[model samples]
Target: MNFNRKQYTEDDLLALYRGILLPRLIEERMLILLRQGRITKWFSGIGQEAISVGATLALNPDEYILPLHRNLGVFTGRNIPLDRLFAQFQGKTTGFTKGRDRSFHFGSKEHHIVGMISHLGPQLAVADGIALADLLDRKQKATLVFSGDGGASEGDFHEALNVAAVWGLPVIFMIENNGYGLSTPNSEQFKFASFIDKGPAYGIDTLQIDGNNVLEVYDTVRQAAASIRQNPRPILIEAMTFRMRGHEEASGTKYVPQELFEKWVKKDPVENFEKYLLDEMVLTSRSQVAIREELKSLIEEGLDKAFAVPMPEPNVAEELADMYRPFAPALITPTSPNTTEKRFVDAISDGLRQSLEHYPELVIMGQDIAEYGGVFKVTEGFVEQFGKQRIRNTPLCESAIVGIGLGMSVKEKKSVIEMQFADFVTSAFNQVVNNLAKSHYRWGQNADVVIRMPTGAGTAAGPFHSQSNEAWFFHTPGLKIVYPSSPYDAKGLLNAAIADPNPVLYFEHKLLYRSVASQIPDEYYTLEIGKAKLVTEGDDISIITYGMGVHWATRLLQTMPEVSADILDLRTLLPWDQEAVAQTVKKTGRVLILHEDTLTGGIGAEISAWISENCFNYLDGPVIRVASLDTAVPFSPPLEQQFLPVQRLQEKVAQLLKY
Candidate 1:
């Protein structure tokens, strides 16, 4: 527990010295590699080795660590071989990612080291989710995420910190204040004096330390981390370091001032630490020199091995099609595990409960659901059963909620993030869309998290509240979106989302969350993800809709004469039912796509495009789209009704029948 143990062995001092020498030597070799044509461009972690090394030593090996690009010292401390790292720099077969991931692209499922993100600010949000999972699983572990002072300028950092603070997520937010971000300096990046001050704004305890002082950095961070373990909230430790190397191998260092360079070199982090160790008698000067030589030899050996490693054979069989799987049209067949008869929202609630029971690492936390049973009672009595540790209430900070959930999910955790109102999702778009959605594709790490948002326009929430933005995610890759219309579909798909390995955005229509009362059997059940359900068996036309729109479209179909509409509720939007849709369109000879979102691009356009391209032979009429009017929804009842799809449903039905 005590970081400064008053005395230490030669091995400990040598290890500390090695951490610095390795990162620094590697930084120089990176430049050599660039000049020697051994590698392409590179991003540097130079001049910031002090805190990374000290912080790594301070943390428990079992704890999760998510680092940004300039975290070489941390990686070295965690035992990532310098040769392997250099191989990544050279983009070779020996590269941990086999030429797929970028240099500094690092993750270890076994070591619990979460992937380092390329973007500066986004990873902070994911750190929260990872920590939440660790806590929910009752693991005696913590997570540390490193960011830069300049990264604080991003909205995601604020989002992540706020959520971690509000929900008491256990994690460390380390700011390596290296004065500059690429070409822009820290002062120009934000109005705040420092990143540490910003942490206090989010209710997180902040500590500013001399990042280059190994003992001081370790002592300060250790105390801060201990406090977080007890309170289980967020803590920000700003470590003042310098970026001695260029931002990357391609960067021109000519712009750096001569005076500043001289001053920084004189106060080199590695040399300074080495001198301190000698003064303190932790290691003699001879031993320090010997260790530095040893580090140089180690680096040389790794570099040689990396060069000697054979290139992987290229496979002509590996085509572009192997990159990803496109969504297909398929019916989500009911399975034995999801055989329970329950309403969609209830199924979601049960799925969450089941997930809690299934994965000890699963943690559920959000704005409210604890005692109030959620805004729609989707999580009624969950806190009583799971305890506050697993089910927690957060302040009204959507950014924080999602950010923290993201943090926990990336590490050894599975977080189920809940947004109280679907409309509130706009506040956390930075975290949800920019951070969680792209975490995996960008970093090659899986963020197994679920964001449950109660969506649609039916509850008369009016204007600011009612909107279907599924099109936003449907258009994006690396994110899975599921919108369920029925209790049965809801329960099954939600369970599937929970069990899936990727980040999933689960949209539960507010209208359907509690709309229908059905006899839900007390049994386990789940529907397959990315699949649709055929609610009706009419062959004249195919009505493709989801959430509340499916119910409304079905009602209109029942009321309209001669319109034997084959109703289809798309359970998942990202990997939607392309096969079932194609087959249904071919069979029915007509297709109509409906949703509660605005008519422009509201999932309907995609369906229409697919039908026109794939089912043109069977088309009797142009594909029609029934959705909320393009105008902003009105708060007034009459205007709202007119703007919504409910009022125009009959007219659309008549038109479809005529077609």
Candidate 2:
């Protein structure tokens, strides 16, 4: 086949050939290592090298690329040192993630690469976030993200495409259709004949091509990136390809038919590209032999160096390090004389407004947060004050939005995302726990984002809208959970969460939006994140609670004038005030832990266990806990009221006082 060199020079074509050849040889070497037990696992990219190599070579060096497990060519095309990559595969400390993660499962910010999670489709949304950051900063950069045909069936895929189309972010969704997801064929994955048909449905430009052709991929991606730079928007490219080997080294290819392998072997990307280079006279037979031999030697040397490096010595300090950036939590004490009576919701709004002004680069995003002013109007006037760029509305894509926030944080941009309601956070559980919460610890990239969760059940919003789900995130180590009751603490805590160096879940009770009001300081202030407040001083017993539980304890105390008890509002649940809890436990010799969540596996359980373990001698009685029944929040107001811990708190407090 005669080649036309209109777009690329002979040198460029040879470079592309080298790129494809390098990964093919590397994967071949890795397979041999897998057999020899030198590496734990290997996701082979033998036949699909052209797609990763050509696509990566087509982009600007600064543009980000989120690669899949099979895109070893993406790393080589970016010129990542083979020695470091070998070390990463060998789990050495010199790797990108410092041996914290193995194989191709980790990202390198220095290389403008964000690695994919096993969930598959969240990286598409994270690419949109990087593109959005480039747009906001007026840097015309395009992001290339990869996924397989089976991964496109995920909800994150649909959400990412819709949001990227709506926002007109500069991103290229590269879908490699290898015909199977693990053992399942494409027939069982989706109903569409081609992913291109679904692109017009999302109003995104689409294209499809033979993924084995190296020059075609390079030319198409280069042109697509240029077009996106001229006018920023997302494009979907379906690369027709095949996986020639098993999903992983351990999983045999018994599921794949022999005829399918025969069909793809003839169309091998590396072999075909090399043939084209020879046909076009870009590579002579002698030169090709020399190149292959040189590459093999380089691979051997890299592997030897990687093998010589020592494995990581994991200690407690090393394990706990980089979970969060260093930032001292401070108590909120306003030096200004100006103070205003504000409702809980308004205090939160004021805090956001102040933060937008304080941090000019901060972005606030949520559903209906633009013109409609959010579901609860927390960002009512934000669009007018900060513009749509800073205060943005997103689609009903919980997972994508959270993943996007984490992606933006990867670029040093801080963000605040509102969940609308805390119950809906379940849709984004994986992104919160696996990606956003673990980003800092795994790769040393801090997810400096705050998620505002409007939680609690007093308004009768049903199971999907009203839920005190603080316990869900309290169990996550990399996250900071803060649930405030009063307006003063609400504003101060919100400020603290935004300024925090780690991912913070700020829970605002839905019932307290307008019902609770307090004298909030007019000046900007921040409260300590992991601190508790003593609302009342007493000696009979101690009540430890947060959010709506604080109000319940207060109401119970008002009703029973005879009982003198210490009311402690634990503003932060994860690092709940152990000192205050111990002091109160020793002072009263009896304690009660309260929350609106269910009794089992709730925050109250942790507090009770902690008191029992640390303050056993100080306790005159067993630590008592009052929480909601172990059932979904019922839609019936009567049932919900019965399910809540209001009456239970009254009964538990009296029992503890008597004890």
Candidate 3:
């Protein structure tokens, strides 16, 4: 984004510089502690100080901050107690991290700094999501996320940017481009374009700034943040900087050349800015020496106090979980919908209605989810019952939609995010892959959240609309994936997803929502994640599948009436029921695996691998497999029909029967 010349006052620069020095002093003291066997370990963001200090200066204390590992400057500058902060590094109970995560990964909710996330990309998307919530609630809080140059290259980075750009949510994406991306440089990360140059492709405004320039970095960030708040969309700021240290404390930084290290040391913001202050006569040599001494004293005082504080007694974790449980409406129960025959749409509608009724905090968001009744009417008439405050229909920005939901989840605890179509979910891929999947792993934070995607191929929607994306999330950690073949399981799993401590990526087979039915109870119920259902029992062979493929396998079983075939439908993808599958494989002695997802790297591959490793000895014959041809599910009715899993069913079944 273009900006007029803006500069900070001399005093403002000194204060920011002082903020930098305090964090460095703390980091250095912690290193000494680690070497002295006085602390477990510490990861200091030594060389990376300017952006952390400067970025904080750009936003107000009320504005939200999502910081990464090297965020001592930002956290300390924002007024997180130096002693409490250092205590956390020492693994004491009084430490900011509560002794849960490693040092340098805690958050101050009071300072409007959200909890620290261990994994990358999750916080970036959460920052975007929080900004969306503030906009919806008519508040003025904008969000900023600080990441290293390495995280920008991950798939989640692109996904988060795409969503932010499309929706124009008020969020800033700051990349601390410190030369190397953990051994890979910018050249290898993006061969097509520079990091900032690529932002426009996603309709985002981007800036490449000198990270070491305290004034330039602060002024540029302030401008970008202000612009985002006014216009509302994603902004990317690439701060060209260097790593004064290694990836982590244990990393000896052997990766950096001596020459580069020397060059960076000369340009260190602390030394250079101190010289600038002295040259301008803004502060005298006596004052500078005093400032240095102040830093040392401040650090020592912080450490002495932190070590004396108690560690979080074990019950802290349990207490946190208890706080998440709902009270009045202990579990979500359905409100009677007059409509009957149980269409998939009705099931989804009931689920929404019930969730809105039960949970005071439940939020529903998607494009055209309001008067338009959502693309498939799953959320039809929800806004009327729940009001716009609860059921939020948003602009068509899938990535941003998910990101916005993430932010809301952080602030409010639970939210339901519906991607218009499963295929369109690619628009918000970053929020799903990076943010949702990694949030808990990184920060010991939990998102009692629901992500609904209308997935699967059928009815000739073609390549764009007819797609199943569960396999993508299946590979990601910290995300629980649910794929239900029937209305009963769909509703059951959705309820469970909302109650889950971690984020749940729920895929609703677009075709099954209205067209399918099962004996769902009128009473409240919940299903456990990582549990597989044994649909049918047989002596001949076992058909292992989930979602639509379960129905297809059952259909194929009808053709082979002479052969007794058992079916195992895995409900959840991540942490799937390995023991059940191994048990089924042993019982049937023969197995045929299937899924509607594509063949290559599909969910089937995982099931197959699991069976190979654990169920291999029990197999009477080679584990037969059935899956859609490794091709983009074609849009044409006839071609799509041929392209799906039907063609492979007979072959796989025959092979399993023979075995």
lDDT of candidates 1 onward, in order: 0.74, 0.88, 0.75
For all candidates, the clash counts are 28, 0, 22
Best by lDDT: 2
The runs of at least 3 residues in candidate 2 whose Cα sits more than 4 Å from the true structure, single-residue gaps closed, are: 1-4, 329-333
- Cα displacement (Å) at residue 133, model 2: 0.5
Return the TM-score for candidate 1, rounded to 2 decimals. 0.86
TM-score of each: 0.86, 0.98, 0.71
Q: Per-residue alpha-carbon lDDT of model 1 for 1-659, expressed as tens digits?
A: 11353455666666667777788887787777778787777777777787888788878777778787788777788887767777776767676666666766657655567665555676676677677666666665667888887777777676777777776778888988888777787667887777766765787788888777776776667676777777688888888878777777578676667777787776677777776777778778687678778878888999998888776566645422223323332333434343445666677787788778877777777777788878788789888888887787777767766666656555557778788867788887766676666555443455677888887765678776777778877876677899877776667677778777677888987777666645553454556777788888787778888888777877776677677778888878888889889878888887778888899877899889888888898898989888888987677777888888888877776677677
Rank order (by lDDT, best first): 2, 3, 1
Give candidate 2's whole-model lDDT.
0.88
Error of 1 at 419 (Å): 0.9
Lowest lDDT 10-mer window, candidate 1? 319-328
lDDT of 3 at 521: 64
Off by over 4 Å in 3: 1-20, 24-51, 54-63, 68-71, 79-125, 134-288, 298-339, 393-396, 518-524, 612-618
Cα lDDT of candidate 3 equals 0.75
What's model 1's lDDT at 478?
70
